[model samples]
Target: MAGGKLTARSAATTKPGTHGDGAGLYLVVSPSGGRKWVYRFTWQGKIRMMGLGSADVVSLAEARGLRDEARRLLASGSNPIEARREQERAEAGKPTFGAMADAFIDNKGAEWRNAKHRAQWTMTLREYCGAIRSRPVDEIDTEAVLSVLQPLWLEKPETASRLRGRIEAVLDAARARGHIPRNEANPARWRGHLDKLLPKRQKLTRGHHAAMPYAEVPGFVASLRERDALAAMALEFCILTATRTGEVLGARWSEIDMAGKVWTVPAERTKPGRPHRIPLAGRAMSILEKLAEGKTAEFVFPGQRAGKPLSNMAMEMVLRRMKIEGVTVHGFRSAFRDWAGNETRFPREVAEAALSHVIGDKAEQAYRRGDALEKRRALMDAWASYCEPPASNVIKMRKSGGGSAV
Candidate 1:
């Protein structure tokens, strides 16, 4: 049976041991009558047996062809078995960018503070990075990254910056996992690489947010008073509290302590994943009291839909209706910050705390014990008075109570 092709009938009858069909190829027969093709070869003075295919599936001609291919590989000094394993490994390594990004998000998203941040990662990659999502991560180069970023770089600089960072992170993870070669330069790197190709974000000449002048906030509140919509009330509350729209919109009755005169923003609702107790000012409490009258819903500001809080855009719509062009709802916080800095004598730390901003480095923050709620209450009181001043003639009042001139 050695060194020649065996007929199908002869192969069927050849029971028991090994029968050869030429160069390093043999049909292995089990005592029970099972038969399969094997390619036997020697590389580096070591003999190896590699399975070609089952005789029932692979014809005698096909088995001979496989034998010839294996002989060629062995003649080239490459072990056929090792070569086939390398080819299998290469095929197994080809993962799409979308798949890699999903894995990265799943592994890292748990550390993120809020669901919205995680959602943004998926949305930005899917929406803005469609060009590279189906491509392999190792195959992504600077051109591929720039193709996703360039169009949005100037127009949506902030989003573009975030997208670039996300891509860099995913690529870094890919390299760490051996999906991509470690020596390959990350195409999304910003410092010395992408910065040369793309324009500096600061030079793009875009406003951070459309903020009304701090001096004009009182008059704006006065104008807001004339509107009767729930959104208007919510806007006024947001301005008075200097809170982000999502915090105010997601407010529930359970969070407010009427007796304590505080609104406890939970860790889940906050940007930093730390619970903050906002000292509700007299005016803020008054607004809540008004809303409480005959209100059966749990939300502080119920939306048009039942069992839901106000939409994120509700306050923005109120501003639009009033023809308050060039000012964003979120910008009111900046207005408050400016007012606190320029017109008030409160310490900068106190003012920053009022905004629920992370005040210092991790070490500094750890040493800082309380939120300075008493001081913030006084500051918020003064702020509410300034926004709803008895007279339109605005003047710097003498600092009073616990939050005195610093």
Candidate 2:
């Protein structure tokens, strides 16, 4: 205790003891000689000490004011310590846009089957939206979104479109978490809102993949057979099975069931993030047999590297070497789809399932769970037959208008 009743000058001079100002407010002095102001109070049979300020800095009058406020809070049944902590916690919960985006990616990345997909999510947002990363998520407005997207909207239409979708997803997630107040409309939503702000993305005259006309696929497959490279065999397998380039090149011997006559593409290797069962046709199985004669690696089509899959460009390079111009390896799937729609009696969903495409909306997909493997086997067999028509079935110089073949 201070020796006597203290004035401001006396409190400042008080050494190494707790000095009172006729109330719970006191000046605490340590033996090592530091001064601080504190308020002492009682609530519910407990004595609690609350720090006010250093006595050297806090005048006597200021300490009294703080002491009175603490008393008022105690009388009203609110603990000042708990109230401060709750306020601190609420502040801590508020995250800036960049921090929340990173958190969202980490949280959602696990569900994404591909590691590349997770990288793309972070890479796109960081590259495009660095400007608003430090801003509070609640303050990210339509103008901020437009500023990031407009530059790339026309310049890089596909990437910009995907970025807009990702941003919308992140914003919706933030809103759901109460990190941001819910707006009437999302700034990044495209349908009726952003469509007005930005110019429409130009529609392609041709499909995105440079597809050869379905009618020419048989002739093309015949030409592909002339080449004897491993890429040629891989491309033919891709065409016969109607599978993606990645799935065909990344194929492992273990994933193929020669007995069941099926190739199971795992979820990580597929676009739809689900395991797909491809009903192997005779031609597809034949190609696998040729490769299996003296297999050297885990991959069905191994690259120059010992155990790795073929390079992404290997099939495209094979087409280039064959002098096939203006076509992509991926375009074969489109050709298969077109032929299935136009020339075949197969149902559209069966064709879609053959290509491992997610048909229709979420509700439609939920109801149509079956992959229709048996029906797809028929469609694939027919497709294989069409790609390599038997010589006996090839009709030359058909007469027109009720005349027999010449």
Candidate that scores best on TM-score: 1
Put down candidate 1 lDDT per residue, 6-53, tens digits, no spaces: 887888788799998777888999988889999998653467899998
lDDT of 1: 0.79
lDDT of 1 at 48: 80
Candidate 1 has a TM-score of: 0.51
TM accuracy, model 2: 0.50
TM-score of each: 0.51, 0.50
RMSD of 1: 21.4
Q: After superposing candidate 1, which stretches have Cα over 4 Å from the reference?
A: 1-207, 389-406
Q: Given candidate 2, what's the lDDT at residue 250?
A: 78
